[model samples]
Target: MSFSITLVIIIITALISWRAFQDNDLKYKMMFYPYNVKHHKEGYRFLSYMVVHADLMHLFFNMFVLYNFGQVMEYMLDFKYGSSLGTFHYLILYIAGGLFATLWPMSKNADNPNYLSLGASGAVSSVFFAYILWNPGATLNLIILPFWDIPAWLLGIAYLAYEYFMAKKGTSNIGHDAHFGGAVFGILYVLLINFEKGQAFISYIFN
Candidate 1:
């Protein structure tokens, strides 16, 4: 979970996305090969696609948020099982969230030729979700309303609501579906881990 490595990934993604934006013929495709749905094609695109961002702004925002949340997650994960496990878990969650994010877009726009998505927002959201699960009652300071305090879970809920609202509105360029899908997957992932270990904290929260 090196911030430098994360930054490098963002830089690479921005380059690819810029190249694609310049040349339509070179537009990057994810799990769906040739960007076609009927092909039913699947591979490591999920892991690779997270390395592509739509633009500089997109890359900046995603990586900024990721670094902000990731530092804590990386440290805790590392402390839990050394630095290697932290890296491994982070990679898995990032890839899994990206794959799930791609699924929603591909399913809804199965026949869309004008739809091409690229960003690490989904993967970042996964990190945010994981952080919340790990630090359930952590204090979250608000940026806009500086005086008000917010809980991590409430912040997540607010994010989900905003994404769902924007998705329904359908006017934003942001990938709201990806955000929702990633958040959902992240929460479920935490629950699954808890279930496997018979953790009481999860039962208290869900119950």
Candidate 2:
């Protein structure tokens, strides 16, 4: 149903992101740095980085996506997994999703002291993919492109493809690589844990 946990996360992230906007030192402290995690023992950045965003736009976009998809995923999980386990697992899905999303980058760029990243894009991507998996036919109207009510599955494929294209160009500041990885985790995590339910969803979507 209308879940509380996702709202709670939005509130916390908003507060942190807002405060970080006013304080550059705080922003730097909360940002994820692979080098710092390995050498300086700043492991907590894995979680902290999700709360502190680069700007209001970044925070708004992420929380907006999470609000739409996370609530759906939560309600669906409640039906199959029960509310208690569903909420608990949702929390794990988010926090662990954020943590796990960083592993690939950390491993690849651990030596680069200047490399830093932040925001909830990784975990939010996971939630978005989960919603896409559970409801392929449902449509989403992007705020910027409200006229195009694209099906979630097509949107997902395009989203990943766009991320891959952007990652190759390296022109945008967005972490497209993490977004891609997080999306993969989102789809796999749900199917891996609930293969029968996933199968049911797939069957319903196609038939």
Q: Name the best candidate (by TM-score).
A: 2
Per-residue accuracy of model 1 over 1-207 as CA lDDT, tens digit each:
445444555567677767766765555654233245445454556555676666667767888788788766767767776678766776667678777877787777766766656677888888788778777677688779888788777788889999988877878877798888888777776666544322544553577
Can you tell me which runs of candidate 2 are displaced by over 4 Å? 1-3, 200-207
State each model's CA lDDT, in order. Answer: 0.69, 0.85
Counting clashing residue pairs in each candidate, in order, gives: 0, 0
TM-score for each model? 0.78, 0.91
For model 2, how does the per-residue alpha-carbon lDDT over 1-207 read when each residue is reduced to its tens digit?
A: 554889999999999899999999999999999999999999888889999999899999999989988887888878888889888778877877787778777886799897889999999988888778877678888879989988878788899899878876767777887787788788888887777647876776678
Query: Candidate 1's error at 37, in angstroms?
Result: 4.6
Q: Which 10 residues in a row give candidate 1 its minimum summed lDDT?
A: 30-39
